[model samples]
Target: MRPQCDPSCFVADHLKKVPPSGIRRFFDIVCEADDVISLGVGEPDYITPWHIRESCIHSIEQGETSYTSNYGLLELREQISELFSKKYNVEYNPESEVLVTTGVSEALDIAIRAIVNPGDEVIVVQPSYVAYVPSIIFAGGVPVTVSTKMSNNFKITPEELKNVITENTKAVVLNYPNNPTGATMDKADLEAIADVVVDNDLMVISDEVYDCLTYEGEHTCFSSLEGMRNRTILLNGFSKSYAMTGFRIAYALGDSEIINSMMLIHQYTMLCAPIVAQLGAMEALRNGNDELDKMIREYDRRRNLIVDGLNRIGLECFEPKGAFYAFPSIQSTGMTSSEFAENLLDDQKVVTIPGDVFGEAGQGFLRCSYAASKDEIQEALERIETFVNKT
Candidate 1:
């Protein structure tokens, strides 16, 4: 028998620098335990709309399982392009500028690798998604995080952006309606930030996966801003809005050069998103709006319930303008975010993600997803109140 090689030595150095996701750590525990009311996962509790699922099923029944083009099905890409044009007035040549990805996750990963060189500085807004920092690190880029305060309602200000700019800065990531915090920025707020990106000549990777979930005002697509069309790589998907997480369908829109570069990385790695998923996503864009609106309405209702419940329970939760998360300050409990989450799970059978898992700026908060059913949210809130009282 041949001697075994040490796995640690074979692992890439950049991969070694990244830590396991803090979001998944608690989720893994929740899976092992029963009778847990979980608000830890960011996924919607609802299933994909039947029409969307039916489309995938019909395609499978017809044996339409062949591998799609690396750019994904042209029909699907056209639908995606049209959706952007109709919704955000952002135009892209589906042939040259749209690259379908397995998920927004992959879209983000490829965007980083395409733009970043070793030691390139990528400014990440925190308490942002857990993947942003690691994606930068994996691409051998430095993640320079600018923390957004709760007092500012978690919106990154232009001064904050200017403070982080340096000669090494390559790009900035913008996610709003932001994950973990559920903050959404309006057009004026984004224009202020866009000015900085334009002046610095830096690329923008805008993650708008939760754009459809905005409750306060219309979502402003970052790429749609003046002077940002060519400078932005727009990433969005069906996971959050259309309830198609399992479909794994997403796309990126950008300058043709960047799209081509991203395709090179994606072709060699992912090859293409699944055909069934592409079909489902096409159906989503074509016929799923009514169903999506229904889900959004329910989410809006649940959002109100959870936010009100959290505040009534004495946890001062800021009103989440978008996405389905309620990020409430846990400082009142005199416990660290991790401790509060752990203790709540142990004592009250409720599951939440520690805010610091998203970033240091999230340290005194807890990210409680309101994506669950109304009953689940109510029960979780009750359990959290009980736990808080004891603490």
Candidate 2:
């Protein structure tokens, strides 16, 4: 029997234009293979440190399970305020300028929706996280992509940024210790870009989710820059730093007025981040730096191992200064990034994300995450070596 349906099928017009994420398609295939060693996922393999997890258990046992304030628990906000000041030299009033959301993911959505009007242009640097473009479009803004080259170590320059700016540009999205690339911006590089941003009066959405993972130098917060504090929305989370990805707790800090506006959107959309997750995040802010430092040290070791291993196997890889992923050029393989990734998964049972999944500019490269165990990383490297040699 044919299923009955509404004669007027309902779907938003934007839904037709929005494509499914390119990153997820490859991940789906990786999930079905039991023997696969996946270097494709972005999150760490480590469990959330015991102390942070125990805090949440304590909260529940104390019957602190009821809903907190819409903005989140005041104690958590106060903790975040102290941590930001101590670590990044940035100041925010927890009462008005800080907002706790479901994750950095939700904070990004709120910032975009609050700041962007329909048809406005938002500048995005690529290859970047998979979420930025779609989130911009969903807020009725057009995304203008600025491609960063491998020669430059994937760092976007002031000249490149200036070339893309125009009257319609509303915001510039910055991600340091970037996903997929592991590239970071130095203070001088940031100062150059800040000059342009301040001159143009553009808002900056700085995503520093991997701030604790930098290898070469300290991670500089854009909001900490001169004249940038009011105009920048800073996105960060417990997921990457505390190995609490499942907790889904993050926050946005910015000008009080801007944060208030975002809070309204957040209230309607998410109500509040999970109460347990917020408690866990608070504990992370209070006592998780040692855990973070330990993880960063491990990631640094794995980073060197993977980068050196790729070079030995004849793949030219950029030595990433931050984050856990390594982006390597696959030009010698005579295959596009997509083809190389698919064939590698099928032939070697090794999974990785194609750089082109990040953007067209990422075409001849692949991103391999070092967030796995040392043993798994070694095995994956051996398989990659064999695959390259045979091909």
> What's the count of clashing pairs in each model shown?
0, 0
- lDDT, residue 324, candidate 1: 91
So what's the TM-score on candidate 1?
A: 0.98
What stretches of model 1 exceed 4 Å from their correct place?
A: 1-5
Worst 10 residues of 2 by lDDT: 7-16
Per-model RMSD to reference: 1.1, 1.6
Model 1 per-residue lDDT tens digits across residues 119-196: 999999999999999999999999999999999999999999999999999999999999999999999999999999
lDDT of 2 at 151: 99
What is candidate 2's lDDT per residue for 1-391, written digit by digit as tens?
9989984468767656678887778778777878899999888999999999899999899987887788899998999888889877889999999999998999999999999999999999999898899899899999999999989999999999999999999999999988879999999999999999999999999999998899988899999999999989999998888898888999999999999999999999898899999999878877887888899999999999999999999889999999899999999999999899999998999999999888887889999999999999999999999999889
Model 2 alpha-carbon drift over 4 Å, by segment: 1-9
lDDT top scorer? 1
Top candidate by TM-score: 1
Compared with the true structure, all predictions reach lDDT values of: 0.94, 0.92
